[model samples]
Target: MTSFQMPNSADQINLREWLDEQSRQLGFDGLRITDTHLGDASERLNQWLAEGRHGQMEYMARHAQLRSDPGLLVPGTVRVICVTMNYLSPVIDFDQEWQRLAEPTHAVVSMYARGRDYHKVMRNRLQEFALLIEKQIGSFGYRVFTDSAPLMEVELARKAGLGWRGKHTLLLNRESGSTFFLGEILVDVPLPIDQEEESHCGTCQSCIDICPTQAITAPYQLDARRCISYLTIENPDAIPVEFRRAIGNRVYGCDDCQLICPWNKFAQRTALPDFAERHGLGRASLLQLWSWTEDEFEKRHEGSAIRRIGYQRWRRNLAVAMGNALADEAVSEVDKDELREVLRNALPTSDEMVVEHIEWALDS
Candidate 1:
């Protein structure tokens, strides 16, 4: 059944057909129907929680049984429509780009945040899918969510056959690798469930070997506390000193595991323009960003995922990068002095968190 325009003759549109057509029209790389019953996913989630691997993601703990039970989050959630959209572009030199990240003179925003805020982009699309369903099936209960929800999105996605859970704990698919976002619509209406995609990780431990912080302790398990993405974005407290240097210029999130994955050769790009690179993001200079005033950062990163970190973390990240830059023997003395002056000026007036970073930048 096509997910788009259901046959005109049917009084009740086949949801399976509707989902397929809409996913195609939405430029989503893949979509699959799934049941809300996460089953073993719920059990594994409980064990993961008990292990405390989630760190300070207390929300994961708060959900309790709800994390596994969609009926608790959205009652009568008979079907879960899981979708994935590839956001990577071809020709990005994985090694060279990450090397630049190691260079203190460069600022490294995560590949995902180098573009627009995916939350804004994905939420709107999910809402549209919900609206389409309402139009077809009449006011059925539904809720649209991306990463923001506590519905164990990866579990649902895996069940939907969108992708297999790679060793790195991300959904990996042949069509797009793991460079994609996952979203789901939990609805009261039942739809035929798609079979789960089988794991293809095999003997390949590419993601584990390539992780800079060694966050992936094993093939299937990831320690989020050691993860750069969680450290930079989720943990607002002072970064654990041990991981700080390894963090390098990565101020937003980390993608070393994904970049090193051989499967990423198949990663696809978003058909929507929303995911394209923004000015001064993908390849901007460290010093150039250091010069941005709070207002400038706010205005430039408008509607960007980077904005969520706020300007202080933005400066803190810059200070860390500037510290790295200062380590570079090639930087001209004059440029180095100028960079120091910027950090100095930013210190007295900056917040405590940023001031600490500024001090670190100076000492570095």
Candidate 2:
């Protein structure tokens, strides 16, 4: 944690220019800056939690102070930097696959995971961004992260004028919308701060309407327990029976809300191919994905975000999708029978939660 000291009076380095040059060379699409202030969100967060909107993702409550107070996480921090990169079109057919889920006969994976793991991609890029800063300012107290903790990424981004936070709680830019990932570098350089932008959600509620589980309880308020992302990736237990059928063909994650977002119309594709999908995940069939064993899951998801759910959740998700596919009138008897066989064999070796899901799938 080495640091460099700089005079308090600002000089004419044109931070915007240096930032643009460094980020462009480092292969970044965009950057924005914000003051350390977080706006009225602190009160809103308190109200959201007082209503128990967070649900089982208790970790959200633990980092409340660190999330709101940047100084608590990095002492002497005066400026926040935010960055975004388009992760759209990693798998070309993902949107089409999601559309197919309407048939209840196709497997639906979240659009974000249709490609490689973003954590690896963003973390590496954030580190690179940090390096660029160090090169300019010499040694400086800074930390880089992308969704690594409860650091109020969207709030900080909006504060930096990166973009406005939409009703869905994602940072949105006029040019890029919210289809990209947000990363940050906390620094104590006392850089001239940027103004926070006004929110643009303005009478729009598409995200709330599109959620299958009604996870967005209200504007900017989310109930994680009902969120498909939480249920599939966080819970690691039997999905509540009420929401299983509504979960549809989504095997790993859900992006219905984001897909329906108006802002995403401006979402761009990446120049970096590392975000590209491997193993045909964007259009994988229920039977195709369900056939994977523990070893297969491990190998296929090697550097992909899909690995977070692990083999157990993988099977659990595929079983639910297979059940949906099996029950669909559009599927062939041969495919249905094959799906049944896969579930039948998988049941004997599964834990109780998985076994219950498998049973539900079989019944479907």
Candidate 3:
């Protein structure tokens, strides 16, 4: 933590504009300021937690209050500085992305997780921005967050005029679409706030209609239990038998909603190399990723977000994808035969969770 310096009246008047310029120089795509209050979000959050929509992500429940009231998380935080960074790699062939997701042999890692970990990337950049703040007007009470805290990032960003929440529940901007990561700096400085942007979703339900698992049960409502992203990344148990076939070859995370959204046509490519595809994960085959030994998994995913799931969840997800691939008529008989042999071979050595998924794959 850096030392804090009190800001003068002139500093307060000009800080927001300076912060925006410096933030852009630091590689953030968008930035806005807003107060710490969350209005009715606290009540809505309470209801969501009570309904258990978060599935096995108990942390969402445990930190429910702190998330809605930013002041509670960082005392003296008068305003929040929200920033957006696009992560869509330039090399992405938008036309083939959906086709790859439906292909049984190719694994579809979520667009965001295919590169270096955003948690590190965002946190480092936010910290650098914070240092810039200290240099301009001295250090103030502030805390940086990059999807690493209990804060309601999407809500805060929406409040800051960064974007509006899409029907799929991710932040959507007219310029960047919903293919960006949001980070925040909770600060004591009372910077002028930006006007919130209004929703532009209209009657378009493309995201909801396109979700493979129908996880977005209603507009702006998501049952995480049915979300492929939640199932593949957050839920640490068996891949539910009901959703396995629908999961297809998505071994890690899901981006079907964003891919099908019309706004994605305007989605910008990331300027930072830290978000470029690493280890060829964007196009890696299920068989290739499945063959990684524990040591290889550790070494390959050292700086990648997918590594957080560990070997068990990784292999379990691959097994489900392989199972789906085995049943896919689109896959060649040779690939199905190879997948079967691989699943059978993996069964004997896998832990109970992975073994069960492997058996299910073989049955498929």
Candidate 4:
């Protein structure tokens, strides 16, 4: 527990302006404040969970109440100071991303996970921002979060006017598109709230239309069970055979929804070196990633978000993609033969789960 030295009303008025400037200096692309009432979003979350749309993510159901109310998660919370940091690196071109997706042998990791783990990068910076706020006023009751807690980050960010939720259900800013990480500071102070942005997605169903697995059931709704991001990263069990063909060569999280979004043309590139592509993840092929030993995977993905998925899941995803490549007529016989040989070589040593996926790849 902590105490607060409340700022004078005049000081409170100027604090918002100061925060905006300081956040920009600290590499935050956008910052906004909002009250902690999440009535509709909470209800929607409960309904989504009831439908089992969250898939194997049992945490979502366990923390439903806490996620609905930040004050419950962090006592004394009155306002949420939401911040956005663009993660799209300058080297990423949307056209190139489409080209990579078309290439059956090329591995496509999500744009966000190609760099350093955002959970660490954003949380550290959020703590600094919170400390700066404390310095400006005095002892302040607050807690910083960046996808660490059970709270509804995207909903809070949407209320704070960081951006409107797109049809794809990702926060979308006209200036930054949907290529940013969200963080928040839960504070006891009653910061002036920003107005919510109106939905600008008029009738754009491009995201729903482009989903390889039809994960987006409707505008503003996503069924995570069908989502490649969930299958590749969150699902601990076998990658279901039905979606394996659709998974294509995505060895990690999927970015199809964002890539097809028209507004993403305005997606801003990040200046932070922390988000620069690592280990050539943005362009690595299925064969290249499949070559990594468990030790190599651990060593290469050190300090990366991808490492959290562990080596077993990593191999599972790669094997699925390699199987998809084997089925592709576009892939050369030479590459397909090599993929089959690699799958066969790993059969004896792989765990049962991985061996099943590897055998599936061989059968393809």
Off by over 4 Å in 4: 1-10
- Give the winner by TM-score: 3 or 4: 4
Q: Best-fitting candidate, measured by lDDT?
A: 4
lDDT of each: 0.80, 0.78, 0.89, 0.92
The TM-scores, one per candidate, come to: 0.91, 0.92, 0.96, 0.98
Q: Which lDDT tens digits does candidate 2 get at residues 1-364? A: 4566654444435656788788767656778777677777877787777777776667878888778888788887777788877777744543575577775656777767777788788889789888877887788788888888778887887877888878777778888777778788888776666676777778999999989989887887788779888888887678888888778788887888777888877777777777776787776777788778789989988998889878888878777777777777888898788888878988778988789899998898
lDDT of 4 by residue, 131-184 (tens): 998888777789999999999999999999988999889999899889999999
User: lDDT by residue for model 3 over 197-259, one digit each (tens)?
Assistant: 999999999999989899999999999999999999999999889999889888888888988
Full ranking by lDDT: 4, 3, 1, 2
Clashing pairs in 1: 1-17, 2-17, 3-17, 3-18, 3-19, 3-20, 3-21, 4-21, 104-324, 104-325
Weakest lDDT window of 10 consecutive positions for candidate 3: 1-10
Residue-level lDDT of model 1, residues 131-194, one tens digit each, is 8877876677788988886788887898889889999999898888998888888877655567
Ten contiguous residues minimizing lDDT sum, candidate 2: 6-15
Task: Provide the lDDT at 219 for model 3.
Answer: 97
Ten contiguous residues with the weakest lDDT in model 4: 1-10
**Higher-TM-score candidate of 2 and 3:** 3
